[model samples]
Target: MTLTQHAAPPEPPAVAAESVPGPARRRPPRRGPGLLLRPVFLGVVALVMLVPLYVLVVNAFKSQQEILTDPFGLPDGGPTFQYLDRVFHNAQFDIMRGYAVTILFVVCVNVLSVVLAGPAAYVIARSTRRRYRALMVFFLAGTFIPSQVLVIPVVYVLKVLGLMGTVRGFVLFETVLTLPFSIFLYAGYIATIPRELDQAAAVDGAGRVRTFWQIVFPLMRPVVATMVILNTFSVWNDFVNPQIILGPGSGLYTVTTGVYAAVSQFSTDYTVVFPTLLLAIAPLLVFFVFMQRHIISGLTAGSTRG
Candidate 1:
């Protein structure tokens, strides 16, 4: 009874529009120009930054005559440790002691800055009252005032507190200098975190202090790391503040002050100048190279939600 009713050959399956192969879709123009542009720009920047560093390192091992003749060239008779050793043993400036003292200052300032700034920022960020807002504005105002301008007044204040030329005085002032921006950064970052976490901690019978440190502060690592890099560089390279505050009389020379002490007497001596300069910057350069990724990531994250 099939009656020769073979079903009409099943209609050919409809061709997918994609399979129909309309004129080949033009691929988005390969972003050739943009791809080339970024690497070119970065190369130029790196070249500019590296040139002086190159000159400094090359000349560091060279004699004054060699440096004067060919400052950019490699050492004529191989790199010398003579200058480096001299730097280590120089009677006027003990590089090792300078390292120890500077590290101590760095540690103290960072600790104090974090300790004071963290709690203050937590309070400022959480509060909504008019005075707390005013307080924030007040802190922000400090950033506009140059540290250079504050040097004299700071001297007077420190003197009154019997802290001038003292390590405590320098560290405390540096810590204060750091607070404004730290709080600003912390508040902005904290704004991005949900209040629900704080409430949850409170529900668990945790006080505000415990809540911030235990729950929220750990979350602030990126912003905190950013602040650390900034403060470390500031305190490390600060010639004027340490010069004026700690003073030569105090004999508390940071790397920069020690460099100035060593070099000021031998301004024309290339061996001393170049080697001392190299030593002064070497540790920081290595640190920055290693932490460059962290610096970029932290700043990027801080900027995003802030």
Candidate 2:
């Protein structure tokens, strides 16, 4: 009975032939040149960028003789604050006044740009009308026209409007210049937001403007931040527009113009040139350090979403 009941011993499961260890697979050799290339290229690029900054910083603390003798060298003695102090107190160009005036212009331009561009972008983003699309094209067209080209025409227009050489005129013109790109950025970003949010807000008795400001505008902070930083840089660093628009005759000097005024007279005076230049850029450098992440994220998010 036991012999009858005993089944043939179960056969072992067949092993996959591929599972048998083959010759050790060889990995492709990494190219030594390719491996070293990226870091080497980056190092070269870094050197190129950092050399000027290094010179600017080193020379700022050194005297005229030290700068000329060894522009690239570290200060032999301890760094001095005298040059910076002189830059601050320069009677010919008040650095504090220049900062105040430039800051004011930056604030005015940002506020005006946001106020004007926000709603216009909302309409352009939501509208199906051909006219709205045409309006968008018009704004896009403005971005292609160089700000330098617009300077002469803008000056003429400002003069006709009795606003030339005035702070109001300068602020207004800068705001106008910002609108095209601001709207373009804003509209693209706004299109990425869900329309259901707008409908929900409307159902709650909110008007289009209210919905946009309260609901949509809050979501647009990233793009808006990107725009604010860009505009700040543009307005802050603009030498040509301010130099011409807020001419010396007007007694209004932005940081850049004041730098020109202080440094132009003493072009070869490293003591004056380096220090003033350093002071002028210090705030912006600090700002960029903090805001650089926002700039990259905002631009990338908008671009990716669009």
Candidate 3:
């Protein structure tokens, strides 16, 4: 009893006032200067980025003499359409044929990729099976593997398929290459949608295919827009894919490859160079401008998981 009682002197009566856990103190809202300066900083960044484009447009009209003399300066005289006309009508390069091929490339890749990816994604997002999950993971893994890395194997395959020089062949390659990214996007977006909708559709006697089209597909609009804009931009502007798949000399060359082939034609003529560059980039710029709103809305709309 004595040995037990001597122990520890009651440990200071077991202090009862230990600090209680509570909500973290919030940092004070950042004050005036930081908030005020953010927009100004962004504006400056935007201006800096636009400078190159400004240079391109301004010099695009200047005479070759003007370009050589004062390339950075504003247009010295009236905006000339001479080089623009040349870029458009130069039968030597067949600019419109390039445009047609490029448009076809974009349309085929964008439309087919989305159509094929959408169903694959829905299956991935809804299925409880491990294989579906594994398949989805397999697709996402593709984003990390650059197309450049597969050029040798792909070329061999294309040669085997006799698609090496043909437009359809290029389309086939582009579509296969495009699918993984498209599926990655669609699957992520569709996962955020409620399962209840699918269940409700099923209860209404809708089959899986019908449910996807009538119920799930419309809900996929945002991702579809995002897919179109992103894929179109990528495939349209891609120089490397076209360069390898369709050679620079190939008549089936897209705008990028065609324009590059024309580089030697101009022979470092800056006035022509500027306008040709402008011609090459105008479609992308126009596409971005028109879809800028849809693009923004679509990207933002699916960020939340519900």
Candidate 4:
């Protein structure tokens, strides 16, 4: 043996514990001026958005004297319910009734639009034919047509059908006005659903109607919730339609019309008018508070898909 016997196999290179695969390396902490600006920016936005609402509520509770003398001051005198009382008693109960009518109109429009548009949307989404695409475009185009332009023709047709000045007539018009947008939204959302779901249902011997009701309709709940919130808000707040179609004497007045009427009657009385305006908006505020989560969820979900 050539006494060159490997020098004891050179004690295997010492394995340093720290050099072994230990926990992952941590990234250095981020530092920048932008990080400090985020909260400040959000606070500014929040303050900007809250100013008008704060003024509305504060002014609503103040007396006409207080409003004129110190528009921005907190009530120096004890807050009085006089304005609300006047709104309730002197406004001919129209405010209350108008709220009822608005609720009815919103519910009717929401149901009718969803029921009618859902199927149409489903068909457009599933159909491969060029005609369906054309129809979808036609529906979307209708939204661009001003309601003012159509008012004359709509009134003429309603008069011929003896539906003018009637709540039913208003409901019908709202349904028609909202339908195009509803169908467009639903169709866009439905397009994102996998066709295999429908096919799978079909393979199980489910017919079109069954497949739609059991499978597709349930999936559309989020979009439907969003549409209901949007449509209800629009129809409830609409002024021009009810003002023109319902006419002055008709009891078919909605909250918007009633508030306008109150404004006309109490033009000089800030106490009366402001309270009435507050009352008119209260329902919408309450509704938004309760349904905001659903509306946001629905919109976000729909956007991700379609």
Best model per TM-score: 2
lDDT-based ranking: 2, 1, 4, 3
Encode model 3's per-residue lDDT on 152-205: one tens digit a residue. 888899899888877777888788888998888788788889999988988989
Please tell me which model should have the higher TM-score, number 1 or number 3.
1
Q: In model 3, where do residues sit more than 4 Å from their true spots? A: 1-29, 32-37
Clashing pairs in 4: none
State the number of backbone clashes in model 1.
0
RMSD of each: 3.7, 3.7, 10.8, 4.1
lDDT of 1 at 169: 96
Question: What stretches of model 2 exceed 4 Å from their correct place?
Answer: 1-36, 303-306
Computed on alpha carbons, the lDDT of every model, listed in order, comes to: 0.89, 0.93, 0.83, 0.87
lDDT of 1 at 11: 85
Clashing pairs in 2: none
In TM-score terms, candidate 1 sits at 0.89
Error of 3 at 302 (Å): 2.1
Q: In candidate 4, residue 131 scores what lDDT?
A: 99
State residue 273's C-alpha deviation in candidate 2, in Å: 0.3
Range of the 10 consecutive residues with the lowest summed lDDT in candidate 1: 297-306
**Candidate 4 vs. true structure, TM-score:** 0.86
Q: Which tens-of-lDDT digit does each residue in 98-131 have in candidate 2? A: 8999999999999999999999999999999999
Over all chains combined, what TM-score does candidate 2 have?
0.90
Of 1 and 2, which scores higher on TM-score?
A: 2
